[model samples]
Target: MLLKQLSMSAILLYSSSAKSLDCAGLFKDAPTLVQGLKPFVAEIHPANVTFVPVGNPAYPDPVPDLPEFCRFGAEYNTSSTSKFRFEAWLPKSDHWNAFWFKVVLHLFELKIGNGGAAGGVDYREMAIPLAKYGFAVASTDTGHNG
Candidate 1:
């Protein structure tokens, strides 16, 4: 039984990680990238967006609720080969081009949460808003099952 389990684990890991697509290839055009993300955003809604400051004593505050949304990842296993992936979008003003990319990283923790039922927050709605302001966004599930 132990051998069986170990074999299964090895097979699973190899299959999942090996099937990843070249994610960078999808960013060829900004508009095309944004357009493709629309459906993904619509599927994940009513997400939680919590904000925490760096080097501050304030407990992370949940941003009442923004119009944005995100898709929560679920656990699963599969025999097929693929990788897991997703997208993140945040609104930006004209000036956002200057500092947006850097700031987006800071909010990743708040956006991704813990990847559990109660942890992950949806932010798909951010795609369009981000795109309209000249931000290119995209995501990939990579085809992994779990």
Candidate 2:
């Protein structure tokens, strides 16, 4: 059997001030956070950060009554040949419950004899339900770009 592994690492930040932060606002400020974490994070594409609203038409299974959130996407170069990609969903301050959710799905395709594929689509669907309950979610494609 072919084995594949998916791994992810994430960093979550909240404002020090008492002011509420919105999804769009967080997305706009994501670059600043990325820049500050340069020592730890290899690279963060500012252009990849985006706001995903409730019921985004782009998703096949649209989130119903989904809270507004910021989506941060990036690729990490840990080694010469290994690349890790991930996506983080942050709910607005007003919608947040101060909880962090990390979803990782390991799929084994017996028929195809493939293993270790990261099930990002499945985890993305899980985000909708978790967001409804006011949780921040982060998902990773491990290093395989699945």
Candidate 3:
């Protein structure tokens, strides 16, 4: 049984690695795909115009010389009134690694809270390190935004 499980794991890993997609190449070659995403892309103020202080206690220190990325939000609808929202950060061609990292945070302690509103300030902070490593990261608010 153990050997079988190991073999299955190896197969899955190999298949995933073999089929990795080059996101930057896809976007560049497919103009229609970029056009379709127009509605979902969020407009971000340039970092130079909207600066967060270095010593702010409420937020994590901003990443210095951060790579350029496209920020976008999407909704998944299961019903007229029920929907889920998520945000994605796609690093530009210069930094893209054709890999994705989804961020999931959970705190079991009673007093600490869930660490601020979902997809709020905390999510962006959490993505910095992953972005530095060239990952395309996505974060969801579970279903509702705070």
Candidate 4:
């Protein structure tokens, strides 16, 4: 029983980590990316996904040197009239700084909190630089419309 449980754990870990992660491919292939996380996240459905390449000025505003990253947004439909949307930014798979990866051994995940009435995952200021360092950044509007 112990050995069986360990095997299952190993399988889960391996399956969750993308072997060939791609910025654009994530939009069509693995939109949600969240699995085994039920009740709270099972209802998540991809609503908007956009991948912006480096040097392209885009929505909200423009960052001087923002790296190419995947922008994903989803809605959690809890009821007929109750649904909230959130967004996430995943850095390029090549590991922005391969040298840093060789020393750090792993990437990092950063979560930004809602600020005042912003009501959106639009923290590009912080998200962009972290993404350049290969950090996975995520933020939510927290059900507000700002």
Candidate 5:
């Protein structure tokens, strides 16, 4: 469905599902998210598609010494460094296990002033429900104004 036809609530719901998709299984389909988001977003594009692994005490810590720290799976086009980038930091079981919520989405710029547009998805609100569910999620602007 086109983004214009979708309600903000719908988009928010869709974005919230970021965690349900498995990066390992869906990395090859990264473009799908971009394509899906295009109609809704203006110039801003989904530069990177990341799949953060679910963090739990059962699994080894990503950084060892930082047993509380973990990393999720990520997917992106290494060639388009200037366009877009995304990353996610996972919380351990001791903290909020946000493995179900795909944590981060970073938007980059290829040129000056080429940043986020007004009609983009409400990622902040989209993250609220996840946070309410005890998920620790985060997203950055990558120093861009958007």
Candidate 6:
């Protein structure tokens, strides 16, 4: 199915088994999270840093004052001629609350975001603020280049 057809639940179903996701151990544990999913084609490698620093030249739109967080990305081979890609930012577990949902009193908050564009997944600007405030966020390219 194309990315446009997938519901948020369907996208998250692939990673439901990851009870606790942390950046420090992601380099070693990320593969297991994406394992056993059909059409899966993620080749996760060991990253040298726990988090990308502010103003790093590596990103296309670097946020100057964004807080450090763990960045994760993957691509799934949806078909012989197409691929779907996405990126997720997790607040460093040690630095802030990392839960996707919080239940305190009668209120619930889910901080995930679909901050992207039709041209590409551009979550950097949106993800930074949420990550700074202790929430995980994500965005997708809808299966194409920027």
Best by TM-score: 2
Error of 3 at 32 (Å): 10
| Model 4 clashing-pair count | 0
> Every model's Cα RMSD, please?
14.5, 9.1, 10.5, 10.8, 13.2, 8.0
Which regions of candidate 4 are displaced past 4 Å?
A: 1-16, 23-25, 28-59, 96-110
Instruction: Check candidate 4 and list the clashing pairs.
Output: none
| Whole-model Cα lDDT of every candidate shown, in order | 0.28, 0.44, 0.42, 0.39, 0.30, 0.43
> What is the overall TM-score of model 5 with all chains considered together?
0.28
lDDT tens per residue, model 4, 42-142: 11112223323232122255334455544544445444665444444444456433211111111342233344555544555444444546654444444
Better of 1 and 6 by lDDT: 6
**If ranked by lDDT, best first, what sequence of candidates would result?**
2, 6, 3, 4, 5, 1
Please provide, for model 1 over 34-67, each residue's C-alpha lDDT reduced to its tens digit, 9 standing for 90 to 100: 3322122212233334432222122233334433
Best candidate per lDDT, number? 2
lDDT (10s digit) by residue, model 6, range 1-146: 33322422333343333454444354444445454223222222222332332322223553344445545555565667876655555554444453442211112244333333343445554444444565555555556541
- In model 5, the Cα lDDT at residue 97 comes to 47
* Alpha-carbon runs more than 4 Å astray in model 5: 1-21, 36-81, 89-133, 141-146
Cα lDDT tens digits, model 2, 19-102, are 644444444554455442212222222222332333222233433444555555545566567655555666666777876655
CA lDDT for candidate 2: 0.44
Local lDDT at 58 for model 5: 22
Candidate 2, residue 31: the lDDT equals 49
lDDT of 5 by residue, 1-146 (tens): 12211222232333345554333323333345444321211111121332222322221222211223222222223233422223333333444443333322323321112134322222343234333454533332332222
Candidate 3 segments exceeding 4 Å error: 1-39, 43-65, 105-122
Deviating ranges (above 4 Å) for candidate 1: 1-39, 42-79, 94-97, 100-145
lDDT of 3 by residue, 104-137 (tens): 3444311112244543324445356445687656
- Per-residue lDDT, model 6, residue 126, is 44
**lDDT for position 104 in model 6:** 13
TM-score of 2: 0.54
